[model samples]
Target: MKVSTIEPAQPLDHLAPAGRIGVVALATDFNIEQDLRRMLPGDTQIFTSRVRNYNPLTIENLRSMAPGISAAADTILPGTQLDAIIYGCTSGTVAIGSERIAELIHQSCPGVPVTNPVTAAVAAFRQLGARRISILTPYTEQVNCEVAELFQRHGFEVLNIAGFGFEDDTAMTFISPVDIVNAAKNVCDAQADLLFVSCTALRASVVLDEIEAQLGKPVVSSNQALTWHSLQLLGYPAPVSGYGSLLQQLPV
Candidate 1:
């Protein structure tokens, strides 16, 4: 037997040389990661960890996932630095509270900026000077009410809110983008400044521009807003177009 050994290649630059973003997604979610990957810059990297989620997609079920947030966050590149971490849930953030979620994530990834869909959506709305907004969701009326109230508390007048009455997180991902556009148009108020489509499990990113073109108003979705806000925290200033108006606004 003969053995040959070659010298190892020189250490290469970090794989995520541009930026590293971590996501703590719901175990049942099938859309957020995919949407984020498609939206972010090619040089940037995405790392994800999933937290166990309860079924039926109720507030209680959503809140059940809260305890494991820190553990899920720690699993995403432990002992390494991340430009930002995203808690990829919309209704879950409303159920558990965005501030509390950020605190839990900080327990593991201390000093790292943490954001969730709800918070990011609010920021996107404010940045676009949208004081009156309408909403569309895949959740039942109960969850829809909470989402509307959360936005109202943030000082934005809720022009209208509508939903598809879905309860399964996984099923929500299968919602057709065309249906989302139609529902958004139906729910959006003519007088409102913007429309927000809530739900991380819904595939809203790919059709945002088309919706905007048809509605003649800006549209913000859970996955799109979260990606935009994460890029903002990472200091990525590129004006990303084709997704929607929010991404092209050039975060400061």
Candidate 2:
């Protein structure tokens, strides 16, 4: 079996993608790429690496997974130069702290923009002018409390939060968009300016607009927020639409 080599004869200028993004995901996750890639334009390319994780996501498990993320970030396609690297987990980011996660990512992909759901969610809420938000997650209540606390510490008011009481990432991936839509409705807070569905594994991207239409509020899911944040850091000019209003109305 033979693999093709890079065509040296191809145009040296702009021959590759306009931007490259590296996403470090959980070992059990299965949907980050399917959702993020469709939101971006064809000019970009995606690279992903999965860190170790397990089911029954206790606080101890979440905290223990933090140390291996930087090593996983190092596995991205070498020589391509990532524009941004995102640690793609909601609950894990809460446990590790976004600042610490950024520090870890920059250690490997220095000078590149670093972000995660926690960081991206904060930025997305700011861009949407949403100070008060309702969050829906597929995590156990134990994990949800920390996630709520994380949002509060970031200065957003968590008007309400609802979780599916799930701990397994693989099971979270199997959660249907309809179930997510229903959960969004159940957790809808009339006082909230926006709704946030938290979980890269939840496949909420496909149903974001529908949930928005039903709730009459913009919805920001884990993958959508991360995709928009990545594009913003990359300084991509084109708007990433159809995912939701968050991507369409970014600040520059």
Candidate 3:
């Protein structure tokens, strides 16, 4: 028998040389991971961990996820570098508050840029110069009101907000793209400068452009905004097109 050690033929490049992103998704969410991965650059790497969440979606249920936030963030590439960390919940972000979410994530990832759907949506709207926005969600009126208030606090006019009155997160993922488009079109205010489809559970990314072309206004979805903002934070140069104007309009 013989044993030998030899030098490698070539030096190895860094893992995820293009970029690496961390996603803290909800235990009940079924759409955010795939939607975000599909929209991110081909060379970019995605790492995801799920936080515990209560169903029958309500403000109380959403806020219940707060305790698991730091644990979920810590599991994703611990002691390593991630360009950004995304807490992939729109209502949950509103429920727990974005500042607190960032603080929780930073408890583990310390200084890594943290983003959520609501924060990402605000940045998307600001980048597109949209002050008047109409919203579509899969939550009940109570959750919808909180989302509206969050945006209002950011100084954007909430033209209108409509919801599917869904209580289960799994059911929200099953919402058909056609139905989402129809609801978005109907819910959007005539005077709105943009339409925001709010929910990580809703599969809205595939139809963002379709709705935009029909309504002649920019469309931003939860997963779309999160991925777009992560890419921007990473300073990835390539433009991600076909989803919506929010992704394509990356700053130079």
lDDT of 2 by residue, 5-94 (tens): 876886676633668889898988889888888887888878889999867887788889888988999999876688889899888888
150-246: candidate 1 lDDT, tens digit per residue: 9999999998899999999999999999899889878999999999999989999999999999999999999999888988888886878889999
True-structure lDDT of candidate 1: 0.92
List RMSD in Å for every model shown: 1.4, 2.9, 1.3
State which candidate, 2 or 3, has the greater lDDT. 3
lDDT of 3 at 109: 94
Q: Give the Cα-based TM-score of candidate 2 against the true structure.
A: 0.93
**Model 1 error, position 88 (Å):** 0.4
C-alpha TM-scores of all predictions: 0.96, 0.93, 0.96
Which residue pairs overlap in candidate 2's backbone? Answer: none
Q: Which pairs clash (backbone N, Cα, C closer than 3 Å) in model 1?
A: none
Write one digit per residue (lDDT tens) for candidate 3, span 31-54: 988898789887888899999988
What's model 3's overall lDDT?
0.91
Off by over 4 Å in 2: 1-9, 12-16
